[model samples]
Target: MVSDFRRKKLLHMYKFLDKDGSGTIDKKDFQLAAESMTKQRGWKEGDALYKESLDMTDLVWNALQKAGDANNDGEVSADEWVTMWDTISKSAADREWLSQYCKFIFKMQDFNNDGFIDSDDYVAARSIAGTSKEDAVAAFQKLAQGKSKISLTDFQKLWDEYFLSEDPNAPGNFIAGKSSFD
Candidate 1:
């Protein structure tokens, strides 16, 4: 069950996602929201705008459908926001898969393989991303404002917030299947 605070947070998130403040989320809303989010992440306006033009709402809708659309009405309602939060909740959902993504980001950020990420790691990540340190820092700060450091917990949260959240037409599924070997 989702707590009231979390429900409110989800509703807030929904408001953000509904870029036009139209209440109902459709393809354009998803595109606009994604564009806004990517831009907020320090992506160049030209680049983010270019990417947003690509139509792929079906992909995003598919990944979020089960959780975001509780009524299964092909649209996300206010109450269904809580359901999406349930999926995002570490306690309510799978941890192993979440950690794998976190580890991936940790390795990427740990540019020197020193087992921890510091400012240098941030620089390296920015270099690889073809963005400046200022831009990278801006994006990080925008995402995690006022935080003193980026720890494993911080990485885990970022991994979920940015990487796990799928674009409407992204290639892979956001929710992974159970291990076949299990």
Candidate 2:
């Protein structure tokens, strides 16, 4: 069972993911974030770049639906989101669901698909989530540890801390933008 603190953290994350303020998480919210990225980057229509973003966002919606949409009604309510986290599969074969989901997103945020997330990629992804580029850059630089890249292990570790750790100074918290819980 997820602790109350962990459940609160998940709720914090849900607020961030509910980009459209629709009181429910759905595909359109994901699309809004994807669209924000493409628009901020000035990607023109029919461009393959934004299309990749769109497809990736769709994949996220699909994954969330598969895991958390208990009613099969296409959107995830706050209660359902909490239930999903509380009931996350704990089997040895599936114990890595949270990590895998983080890695999946980290992979997408890698931008250049170079197996690492550099400052540019980090800022780009953060911007889509409504963070200021300056704040994102500072956070990335602090987390990057003077390296120009962030490896998958490092990325996953941050995410682990983000979802499971209560450390106030964790870089994982910074990566999630302006979390009110912080």
Stretches of candidate 2 exceeding 4 Å from the true structure: 89-104, 107-115, 120-124, 132-138, 145-148, 164-171, 178-182
Could you give the C-alpha RMSD of every candidate to the true structure, in order shown?
Answer: 12.2, 3.4
lDDT tens digits, residue span 55-84, model 2: 777876787788889999999999898877
Q: Pick the candidate with the highest lDDT.
A: 2
Clashes of 1: 2
lDDT of 2: 0.76
TM-score for each of the candidates:
0.44, 0.73
Candidate 1 error regions (>4 Å): 35-49, 52-58, 87-153, 158-182
**Error of model 2, residue 103, in angstroms:** 4.9
**Candidate 2, clashing residue pairs?**
none
Query: Given candidate 2, what's the lDDT at residue 41?
Result: 67
For model 1, residues 1-182, the per-residue Cα lDDT tens digits are: 66553344445546655767778665667666556445544546567433532323435545566546767777777766565657666464544534653565465466566765556566556555455666565554544445644666666665564423333222111111100111
